[model samples]
Target: MNSRQIKLTVSYLSILLISCVSGTHYLFSVYSISIQERLNFSSVQINTIGSACNYGVFLGKPVLGYFVDNYGARRVCFAASILIFAGFSCLALTYEKIFPTSFLLCAFYLFWTGVASSGGAVSFLTTTAKNFSSNRGTAISIPLALLGLSAFIYSQINMHFFDDTFHFLLFIAFTAGLCMSFGSLFLVVIPAPQHVSDTIESGSNDSISRDDQRIEQTPLLNKNNSNTINRDQIELDIGGWQLLRNKDAISMILILVFFAGTGLMYINNVGIIIESLYHASATPHSDAKIKNLLGFHVSLISICSCIGRILIGPLSDIAKNYFDLSRICSLLFAGVWLFCGNLLALLWVHDIDQLWIVSTCIGLGFGVLYGVAPTTCSEYFGSRHFGFNWLVFKSLNLM
Candidate 1:
């Protein structure tokens, strides 16, 4: 890739990283406790808010994809960033007052955040698809890894500043505002290559020329001329539904659904698991120590998640080249890590180290899954409708 392509790639990746990290910073298990305490909410009420966010993501992805496909990525990305900024600002400002009724606040915040984040996903994937065809897998994976790093940074910030809920909200709002302002401006200039349009036109012309030559060369009296004619080549166009009907596409979508769903479940629940484990282990005498330990565990998980995101993409590229494994195998490995992480948490009774180890494992697994899944979708579906296709699969998984 040239300098421009590299710059664009880095910018998009940065935007994606910021969006994810900013949204997730306050969504971790520690925040759940803070929100509950501030608003006097029951556990059930808090869970309901989480469910709302998940369902919003499930419903919003397809709509966002369609908009991205019809319009352009720049508009969608800018708008989404604005929404994310607004959502986070709202979340930070009202989290204290919004508690049990905060379900409404959370739902609203999640709906916009979902819309914004989905746009970032589509934009980044499409940009990467446009830039590097041969190393597309690596390109996609790299951004996911960066997102992990962002998560780590955000988690640390939360851990340090989260003692005062009101102050934390202000800090999040200010940070999100800056990211949105810069991210939107940065995204506007990410030029789509002229060669993309040229290539499509050239491919279409080549198809037409080949069809004409074949028709002319064939004997008019040939019995099977019709059968020999390649309709797909002649048409030089394929619809999204036609692509979806392919067996490979169907299989790929199913795999992506499982991959995304399980990956999200882990991301959403890992902190909760750690907190609960620590809370359960600590006696009344050791409450403060256990709470501090749990905070440390959250920080470690965040840091590991960042490391995993940065490394997983490059590692997967190496694995794909060296081991000659399919992308599905990479995804399966991530899934296994998730299962093992959860199992470790379930079986290991009271050890903080065990909990931290499991959290780290889960973070690594999430990094791999997030990094590889979108790239796999692009490989199977082609880049033209990548956003729409990915959203379709992601929506299914979220549902």
Candidate 2:
């Protein structure tokens, strides 16, 4: 209810909107089949194109984070909006064979769009992490949860607004880009408490400016949190390479790699996976039926994924605050669902209907993993170097 909280609320809404639009990259399967058929793309080629968006996010994270750290998220988000707009526009044109490019070129265009989307996504995460100290988990969960819901939102949009595949692509380009532009216009970065601390301590505050003092007195820096936050910041400042040498850092990376790999394998190959399951069960399908089935599964995945992401943040807070659980414990909790999902898919998923359960668990697990990892990474490494550190460690998600 305070002005600071109000500003935080506004920023939260902006970032969530941006994330919801940009994170549609995860729904590549929805349009991949149509694209493949139209372009006469091979399976490998289609997969490569689908993976390009994520790869763009993975590869661009460090760069985007660096800009976010130095210049703040607003500028970076604006640039991202432009990139997404141009990339998608170019993609639509390419689909129409306007430039007569190969599939590789098309993949590159998608990759470029993804890079832009990553800027928006990372900006949101970094902004939230930098601004909030208490309840960091819940703060981040808001936007990230929406990001997980992107697929569902897009699915509904396609189902209701756009009838054809080609039109859907154009609409994504126009609508998502417009949303990103609006988000960029609205986003504002809050200075970190530590930075404000240093400024006040350095005699930067005039006599009448007592807000800084009140800020210093805020419970965000009490004995319980300040010590932990300071310690994390110190460890994060130990240089990225040196921090990489830490056992905790290595473990986090490996855990992310494992969970991310499990989820991404399904995401990238979702269409084929569903088809294979349908065939195995001798489920007869018309084109409309297949599309409907895929949409239903995707909707389920998005719904569960969003719910998992939103809930896990607060759950981690509970475990951390009440049970004195470490970040690793929160991570292991995430791994539980990932393991179960994969296990069910591998051992028991012999029919189309059973794949529904697998998708739910996998989506839930993936969402939870993404939800907590960034703030946890910032806690372990330090918020100062969070951008680069998170990017490096999180590359495992792409793998």
Candidate 3:
């Protein structure tokens, strides 16, 4: 194919693969209650496992980034997909069998799944950054918007089909296997740029005289300058331990950890909060039915989240270029929205209508962070080392 065709094909496939991975989060949310009931665990225990899984995501990306940089994106992408498949298989088996397993195995299942899927977001972002230097913001935004579409679709399916614990686990395993298998097969390597040289000569006599004089008089000087330039160009290959030495990187990591920890906490618990409020306020007979309606409330949040992701990236880009504000401002706005969303949930949300309003607001606000943070890190650190740098930042979010 020609250059334009190649670019279009890569963009489409990358977005499709990335969206599949992002949709896993939605799947997990939908299955959370069912899994907890089947596993015979308390809400606290399930939340702890969920937190550990998020932490696993924080740890997995940087290790994958190192491999991605050394080997190639295609290898990392394929490997991650395989891991995801294996993880889901294990989850299915673990749930299906009547084994009296310890908490550690449960944590392991959650952790590995998180790790396996961690590469999905950044890998796609890196692919977009490499492919579209001019419209990187728009490219990133489009896939992210598609990822949000998963929420909309999955919410409906989850509401309708995830009626029993066994069916839910089967669905998760089947979908994960199918998506990973197809995505791995279709994953493409972006070709390196090809260069063509042009030959032109002007003032040949004068150039020859200058070259001759320089060669004779400054051989040592030229060698020294060349050595210095080479040394300057040499890059650092530090892992997470070494990266923590840099204060700026450390600070960024801390910020991401706090943001992700609280942000996910809010996202995960919103439905539960709404259900509790509805049950407490509703008539006695209506309480059980209202509790079941939590599924609808969670779905609304997912839809709002999708909307936010679709809008935030492009909006941030425009604000950065036109208003000449820092991109961090957009992230800060997202944070504010999240904080406000949680506060609203705690203070307000008495009925179903109030729940929808609050959930949508929170969903939109959370989307800002999801959409903007990865792109912001890519912008801050040069894209050449983005795999390493952004992985570090992403790991923090996992925590």
Per-model TM-score, in order, reads 0.79, 0.88, 0.79
lDDT of model 3 at residue 283? 54
Give me the candidate number with maximum TM-score: 2
Q: Where is the poorest 10-residue window by lDDT in model 1? A: 230-239
Note the Cα lDDT for every prediction shown. 0.61, 0.77, 0.62
- Model 3 deviation from the true structure expressed as Cα RMSD, one decimal place: 8.5
lDDT of 1: 0.61
Better of 1 and 2 by TM-score: 2
lDDT of 1 by residue, 1-399 (tens): 997767866775555654454334324454566666667777777666665666656677777677766776667766766776776667666675643345677757766665665666676566566555545566666666655565456556766657666666566556655665566555433544565445445646664566666644543233443344332112222236786678867776676676556656656665566556655665454534544554565566556655665666666656655564567777787778777777776677465456667777777777777677776766656666766777777778764
Residue pairs with colliding backbones in model 1 are 98-102, 99-102, 145-309, 148-306
Candidate 3 lDDT, 119-218, residue by residue in tens: 6655666666555443456667777766656656655665676655555555655665466556545445454343200100221323434454443343
Clashing pairs for predicted structure model 3, backbone only: 58-395
What is candidate 3's TM-score against the reference?
A: 0.79
- For residue 246, model 3's alpha carbon misses the true position, in angstroms, by 6.2
